[model samples]
Target: MLITDRHGRILIQRVDYRTTCLLPGGAVDADESPAQCAARELQEELGVTTTVDRGLAVDWVSADCLNAPASMRFPGEILHVYDGGTWDDEQIAAIRLPDREITSVEFVEPARLPGLMAPGDARRALSALRARINAAGPALLENGLPIAPTVLDRALRTARARHHLPFHVGPVPEQLSVVQVWGWLLAPDGRVLVLLEPDTGAALLPGGTPEPPDRGDPFITLRREVCEEAAAEFGEPLFLGHLCEPDNPYARLRYAAPLTRLGPPPVDPATGRTHIRILATPEQALELFDWGLPATDQLTAVHQARARLGIPRAARQPLTELPDATDLTTM
Candidate 1:
């Protein structure tokens, strides 16, 4: 069972006998199906009753893969990884553990699984997580390795290296000044444009600080910066919201606009670097930003803005280079 909390932390169980922790599951019984066994195990072990409808991954483990005690002979088995579903605070509080076998359960960040579990377990957990985000159904694994990985699985590491920035999103404070501006510049398909730094894999949206020539208008700053950095033009802009950081006097403004025209990639005069432009779904963009759980709120805002704009939700696809000479007038 691959269980996660609302914050995307995985549920791990520690056993009395094993040095390494395990995901919350056990051996299957003869009369129970895999899904039934998963539910029954949860009830017996954690005293929680929940439906297990989604299968995240299936792996075939051979006998040679097991590390068994000399007294116990190991046989190969087919393992099924089921979606335990996301648990809220109330549901999590109701969990009860059996006294003998399972010692404790902890919700851990995906990045910490490597240090906490065996290599195979860690790999399977990560692959399962990526599959969930992919929203493309379950994946197939062999001994915990993805046989055919998704785009995110190939490019994104479970232990995503991210820089933590204190950020809060809401209406811009009346008294606070605007320091920087960024836009969720959307294409016809509702995918947002993101600028990627080739050297660091860092991603950012188009827009930047207001320039002296802009006369202090944030919209002017966004227009100038988008053209300079992305070689793109956008139609009328819609104010999405602003983000504030503690002790910072200036608020970072965010907007959404339909991309009008995209020219060939050009060297940004301000930074002298040509960033790789990518169009990603909102979910994929959140992973690329690597802002942890708070990103969910930002995503909600994004979807709300999308609704107001009447843009269709973009389907999940592998990250690809944004093509130049694209025309959205037809859309």
Candidate 2:
């Protein structure tokens, strides 16, 4: 089974009736472990021309397998899955699986995995795997990722190694600013509470400062920023402080967003990524604040945000800091 991220479709090959259309893997040779076997089979079938990325997990499929045996085909299989730690999708796709025994291969979105997988335990395996990945990340397995029973701090250990990119404790940027945005939330009395133009010359909140991912929390930055901004602008909160990042900035996305960004645009300095998304809502801003919302000519990023407010502060900080959400509630 060659792994790919074709939008979301995972391509699979049904090699034979015994195995069905499954992730690329096969029976281990004498003295070979399942991991060695899967890697070998994927390369053998998909062809080693493509690199296997980091290992995702081992799925246990002997119990619910629908294939007829050799009696039940495989009574159970410990599937060692690797995402193929793909770097470039284009490069991966270019690799051809010329082995002729492969009957058919095609892309199927992960969401469509349940329907494509043969029924019985495989369906359960597919469903459970999807749920676990959605919740705990794709690295955990059906039997659990840490089943090895290794000796370590039970609280600290995870199945993940240094291979994956999305989360790296030392991998995260050390210092980052928490930007507190305050926009007009219409009051029942019709008093539009907004930062004074004379104060900020813009409707954005006054607080923007760097904080550690580990220590002098970003929440502290947010609260301290709000107070300073409020004092400078004589802006009083109609409902108090609100904070937002590009996509929760600190968390995973909650919903699917449809974006048609065709661009040769600016890079986000904070993320150091080319895909720049600079947006906020009074509802989103107000989901943490309150009100209908305020229109643009209102938001700014990092250092420039502070500079525009006339609040003297530097946006730079060491990456060791972690955001303290309590700072806003503490006041």
Candidate 3:
């Protein structure tokens, strides 16, 4: 199992009898699958319970290639690596170590893995890390298998680029008038709720600029704007962070989540703006935005939300024409 924190730091454990560290996983019991073993071992060794998702990587290690002592070497083994989703500081702090076996647990930066683990183990960990990175972007898979060196290299490049990328919203301008907030309102069927501007037939997330009554809280602003613009009530918004262009520093790109539509949408009063919402798959949404005036920041925010929610990237394809705009005025 490959466990990590929100910051992408890998969680490694030091065995009581070993000098090299390994991930929090062990041999599967007779009745357990690899995924079951991963989750059970995590809680037994680390004191936290987490879901073990699908395999990230599967590696066949030959007995001759093993880095352990000759006496301890066994037959070749096939390892099933699963993703132990990101945890926070509180979860890390709550770890309960079984001193008899797991001596210590610590999160280590991926760059330092070479010095901390055995060569073979380090290679496995690095492969798992790359898989996690690729999970955040467009993944390269063929015939149910990930392309070897290319996928790994692409993931490494993405990870390096993201580490250096700036994600900050610039200094607040004195005359900043509107703090715009939006929602990536997801449905159970994996469709995203979007709004269409009636006048220009432009696509937008279901949100708008904050009004005076918003009380300066972005969450509050989001709730109000979503209701006013979409005529549908949403649950409390989870802040997904911000996006901003260098030239438009005052145009804040705030997103919220756990979006639940309470009822049927009523027609919006705002002139030239359609209240009719569009439920599009992530791929369709991308194409729709491409056909209209693209809101790059909104698209970025959508990707961020998807990453946080563990949603896979949609496969890209060309569309000859855009979908018909939904007209709220007729509703």
- Every candidate's lDDT: 0.79, 0.36, 0.60
Q: Better model by lDDT, 1 or 3? A: 1
Largest TM-score belongs to which candidate?
1
Writing each residue's lDDT as its tens digit, candidate 2 over 51-168 gives 4444555566555443445755555656555554322556556656754766666755444444556553244334333322222233334433333321111111111111111211
lDDT of 2: 0.36
lDDT of 1 by residue, 131-160 (tens): 776666788888788888643554334344
The runs of at least 3 residues in candidate 2 whose Cα sits more than 4 Å from the true structure, single-residue gaps closed, are: 14-20, 49-53, 62-75, 87-89, 120-331
Q: What lDDT score goes with residue 112 in model 3?
A: 61
lDDT of 3 at 125: 76
Task: For candidate 2, report its TM-score.
Answer: 0.38
With candidate 1 superimposed using the best TM-score fit, by how many Å does residue 142's alpha carbon deviate from the native? 1.9
Summing lDDT over every window of 10 consecutive residues in candidate 1, give the lowest-scoring window: 155-164
The TM-score obtained by model 1 is 0.77
Q: Tens digits of per-residue lDDT for model 3 on 1-331?
A: 7777655568898888789998888988998988889899988988888887667777777778766787766766667778876777888788999858998888766656768988777777777665554444322333223455431232221112121113333444555544676677654444566665544345567776777777776767777767777655555454555544455545554554644453555556666354545555554554333212233444566677666765555443211111333322221
